[model samples]
Target chain A: MKKDEVPQDDANVLEGKLKTLKYATNEDGSYVQVQTVGWEPENLALSQAWEDIHERLEIIAQDIAAGKSSPILYFMEKCLMEPPMLAKHMGIGTWRVKRHFKAKGFAKLSQKRLEKYAYVFEVPVEHLTQFDPTRTS
Target chain B: MTNKFNHRQSAHCENGVVSNLLYHEGIDLSEPMIFGIGSGLFFSYIPFVKLNGNPGTSFRIYPGYIYKRATNRLGIKTKMRTFRNAEKAMDALDANLEKGIPTGVQTSVYYLPYLPSQYRFHFNAHNIVIYGKDGEEYLVSDPVMDDVTRIKRSDLMRARYAKGVLAPSGKMYYPINVAKDFDLKPAIIRGIQHTAKDMLTIPVPMFGIKGIYKLAKDVRKWPEKVGERKAGLHLGNLVRMQEEIGTGGGGFRFIYAAFLKEAAVIMDMPELNEIADGFTKVGDRWREFAIMASKIFKQRTNVQGDYQLAADIIVDCADQEKVLFTKLRNLKFPA
Candidate 1:
């Protein structure tokens, strides 16, 4: 069958045939899922996800409260991207990007890095530092 | 926050002194002066009043007179010199207030850029009070409304003052004064540090199962509820982190994802199985997008890489459920 022509019954049958599967989709039109025999355990795992995120986020929050610089800087440096490129990749706005660098006392470095990364990202310089990265995702 | 609280208390003490001095000595203070002591910021004349006969409407009176009057009434003597900065200004004011009196003076001073108005920024006033000194650093009581706060001169130097209020035309107000020989430095400093610690340590339990259930209720309706929760969590984290880090940066994404996830889950209503199926399909795609975005962010920002690693270990421990969280938002809540 063509990509969108698969019968609903056939799709359901195929999904049921897979003993341990929960199908999902991808941007490229591919299917993905999680399948496991122990439904209860899986459900519990899903429930605990928020706590996991909170725990990790708390450390960063603490570091922030202690007057430490944002860990994003270290992460970007490690990733080999200039600060602006990293900011762009993260979907932060230009104004906010500048403010972050300024607040961290690294405006000069941030500005320089933005120019360097603009070429590598192959997008407009403006696009590299657009308003919100998360929106696109 | 501690500094802010202590400053407020000290201000109250100063206000009492001013009130007592006025009642007992029959010293007539300008309305702005009284308001200054009341609100911890200077007030402008409201056209009906005149100062120095200039038909003066809107002017900030110098705070020195209030300090001098209070000290003189209390029979305290200390050297006074005008300083260029708020810190020096506070020290001179405090010292003069504490002079021969066995008890040191507690006073809070605030600077406002312009007269308060409906259109003006709500919190344009910045306050500081001197309760004592420690070693080389003067201990300050900050009118932050939290609790007693003491801060080092060094820390205060780094802290931002009300920019507009510090300007030439900004009104300066002094609301509190004290005449007690109590050294409150240690307490104030302890308070500030404690507040910082508390903010950092506060826990935020994500209601994941409830969030998911809400999402499963209706996708179209999910955004608002999820947005509200996400905004709350994000703001909480931001405030705490700003205290810890001294500044917040590039963390809005975490909030955004939480909001989106909540919306996605809500869209997957069980009643609309067909729509729910489509939503699940789209949800997977959204999850993949979130993961890709997160990876890109990690590659670019490198924020909390170690923490991310730890989270990865936990994800592994939980048998790596293929929920959108681990891959996308990097946060997981209890189901």
Candidate 2:
């Protein structure tokens, strides 16, 4: 892209503070580094990704409210982890992790296991057990 | 904290880190030059490997390879280590900092608190340079950031040990020695030659120019195979991979073009200037594909026809890249 033509669309993804470098051609036809705040397509893609994440979180919240699943499921989604990956981090069986997704299974959890979940999610023990989905994360 | 340790931001993190670190050692190399010498331009589409529930489409070589390859090609001795214990890793990094050695660290973006909130995700391969430690905070020069930032020691540890795919596991590396007066001609030629070989001669269908074609085919089938929403998410992923912050625009195409331009002048081959321009045009084609894909993803246009158009643009990129790499493969560098 020509240096003059580099897009500075003021993409909100950068939050108007961060600027990223882009390589563009100068008037002399030589490439020079140019700083861009944002680009339209990139911002769109970023928002779309976050939208998907929020939608997934919303579904998990509903499941938690319905007592079909526990707050562990909500926190798991918040951490952007799948069951297998979270289990690997926890150093436990994937089946055990899946079982904890249930409200009944979570309530029967030992204090040690709850602490593990809280630590993995970077939340406090109380937050893990007393999660209120109505509160914005 | 280190005397005159200047941090220069570049388009991609690894290239920026490599270039900035070399410059600190009195070896001045541009980001594109390091990128070219490292053979960083690459394409890969792994269907079975999912990132954020979308099929993985990577525009460059895997993390850490660029620094490894570029330094090796330049005959620069370096040391790299990954630790099983976080305390040991921090201690090693602290020791290196005390010696005034700027270390390249691989960390996940999610744990980097300085980044814009929107930019933070579970990406585990983001590269940064920690030049000094001030009290409990580490001074960081993240390549994609416009300015230097500081991270607390605890946060830095979390970032370095971020879990999930491509976990960094506290990886740190730095050049231990640099030979005086090494020639760039041989490194440049070898770099170009290796990239040509990788792009044109790779046998795997999921890699090289073939990967572009494979992605094109998949794009055409995404709407039918998956539902519209899922397909749109997939296309959004393609856009994100291509135009995202670290790519230096056009998924590293512009950077590659700049490399070709520099090589043309250094090698005294005037024809490479034209090829650089050709590659720039190819980069624009990639951008066009991104625009069309985004439109379809947003449903701003007719989804069916636009998918075909998007696929055609990708196919065009594949064809152009095939021709360009072939030309590069056949080029005779003066001995």
Candidate 3:
């Protein structure tokens, strides 16, 4: 794929988040190197993939609101985790995790269970329960 | 800031850091060249080895292998050290930066605030260069990023000490001396031969071209074996391995093709360009596989096609790669 090349005006220009490349030429007897930076097609594709994941998260958040899904599902997708992995991280059984996947069951979870889940998701227990997309997402 | 370190970003992090470091040492090489020389291309699907509760699928070799192998092959003596303490690690990094030497450090992407929030995972093998210190933040030339990024000392320390399978362990590396007259042909030949041999000669069913076929077979049975939701997540991680961190676009086939394009010119063999084009087609096939996977994964619907179809596409990719690598291994160059 052809990469987008942009000039490097030091490191502070792009808030340190863009992709760039520098090229060197053996065209003549002297080797001349020119610095440039820009986005490649792959970059766009990657960003698109991330955006798609966010869109899914948005839908998942809505599902949580509409009682169609549990907030656990949203956290799982957001953290790119699976039930089995989450179970392992929480040091609990997969069946227990399946139960926690329900909103009602999640609400009745023990404080210890909530703490385990909160630590695994790297969020506070309150935020884990009262998940606001604006605050966390 | 000292302009001695000419940072250039590339498609992949490890190889990009290798290229940039080599350039700073006055031995200019492209990321593809470094990648090819390191024999960085690989494929593995180990169902027994679980990561994130799914089968671990890998598109390339381990993270630092490319830099290590490429530098070693070029007869470059590099200083690589791992610190037991974060403070010592920072001291070592500062010591090197004080001498105007850019240091390449292994870090976790999860703690890197500059990365897109979604792309940050618990992966601890990300590579970046610290060229200078600008106050509380360090000047980091992350190869996967477009420009130099700044990070607080605490964040950098956290990233260096991030916990995972392949933990960084506060490791940092820099070339102490690079050979002034390193030859190209032998290194290129070795790299090409090594890749072709590994891909075509590996007897294990879980590795190389056979691994791709095995993954296809497993993908077909994913839903039945693991149920619907797990199957979707498994396939998603499989593609995430391919697309994220420079694997998704035809599994870096295009990048290798670019290497071949440069190699043809470096070796004065125009025919390699034609071979490069052939590999590009193979890469295109890999992209097609990713697209099919995304369609099934994102839509969460089995209406258009099933995992069986995606697996078949990958089997085809394996077959095509077999032919490409075979030709690459057998091609003759003037001595």
Candidate 4:
């Protein structure tokens, strides 16, 4: 039966039941269900536009989990230049970038934020900075 | 200068020849030599045995100021160690008036055996006395250097042979007069406790950030009023933020998301045509869940004395919505 043809109450019930069964499985078992949710037409069409933009972000996270992110070298290159240009290129606000650097103990030029910055550049959807939208550039 | 060396060398050397040779060199030769022994304090020393036998020995070394009195007398204190080669030992002993037994006390030069090959000979051997005119050089009775040689400050610094002198092998011994009071147990306990507390407090934000990101992804398609394009952008931004900031809220994801939500509400472009009503309900639910998680987090911090409970709240919320959000996004909404 098509998802839209199904009654709203029935869909809600199925969703709740599937959810219960879904979370019951362990981490490995949940992957199929996770993908299935994204594949459903009632959901996919509504979120497709944004999903494309987020694909890079998902890939970056997967890279981080897989240990491919290099936070050190990136920050090293960043340090040899002005903070503003680096922030702009990275699509984050300068203050936010600075805060991240501070928290990660990269206060010195030798320190790098390769992994963290990789994740940032990879995901382009969020507001990477603290710039007030109302403020004119 | 002559009197002090004569007193320390009298027990180890009896020959007048070595003593005469040192007097010719312009070295002061009298000051008691002091050497910093590394692991020497652990092996043949008294404190090391005490500390190993009773774990509380650390208290004396690091007593809290408030409990100084109670811990001060817990262990013996000793003067630092020094050495003299055979040449200096003979000369100083020969110049002394008091024969047989001297006025100053002579302590053993204790060292370790497993030291790097360069130091093996000095390991646990009685090689020298604390005498020499220059005060920095050791007149050695060394079996390794042979024929009562003189070793300079540079040689001693590079000598990795004496374990007791170089490393604290958990032992210490010295003249009775040089002993002091110390306790070792409480100090060790305090160190362990401080480290444990630090580990517990610093990782909560990372967990919260990841949890919220996952929550946003699950509810991305639920808000139809925000339109597909806008909702997608919001989710994309969230994913981006998670990658950049480490999805660990560092305790700030909620505030940031709230602002983004406001932007969505104000823009009102109506891109979510097919599933507008369903999307609104899901958006409301997502907001409610986030607030609930935040409340639980704050309460856990206040009552439980840790962020574990708060992190668990996030994990639980994520677990609950994982399937629903995925399905919502994948399914086609009726126009």
Best by TM-score: 2
Clashes of each: 56, 0, 8, 88
Candidate 3, DockQ score (0 to 1): 0.15
Tell me how far the alpha carbon of residue B135 in candidate 2 is from the true structure, in angstroms, after superposition.
0.7
- DockQ for candidate 2, please give it: 0.73
Of 3 and 4, which scores higher on DockQ? 3
Instruction: Provide all candidates' interface root-mean-square deviations.
Output: 23.6, 1.3, 6.8, 28.5
Give the Å shift of residue B326 in candidate 1: 53
List CA RMSD, all candidates: 25.9, 1.4, 6.4, 30.8
| TM-score for candidate 1 (chain B) | 0.24
Tens-place lDDT per residue, model 1, B105-157, is 32212211121111112122233444445554544433222233345554343
Q: Candidate 1 — which residues are off by over 4 angstroms?
A: A1-137, B1-128, B137-150, B160-172, B175-228, B231-335
Q: List lDDT for all candidates, in order.
A: 0.30, 0.89, 0.75, 0.27
- The TM-score, computed over Cα atoms with residue i paired to residue i, of candidate 2 is 0.97
Best model per lDDT = 2
User: What fraction of correct interface contacts does each candidate retain?
Assistant: 0.00, 0.67, 0.15, 0.01
TM-scores for all predictions: 0.24, 0.97, 0.77, 0.15
DockQ of each: 0.01, 0.73, 0.15, 0.02
Residues B1-335, candidate 4: write the lDDT tens digits: 32233222211121111222122222222110000000000001122222111111110111111112112222222232233343343344334313321112122232212112211221222323323324655443322111344445434432312232222121111222312222223322232223223222234422222324333333333234344333333332232222111111111122122222222233332222222233223333433333333343223223321223323443444443333333323443222
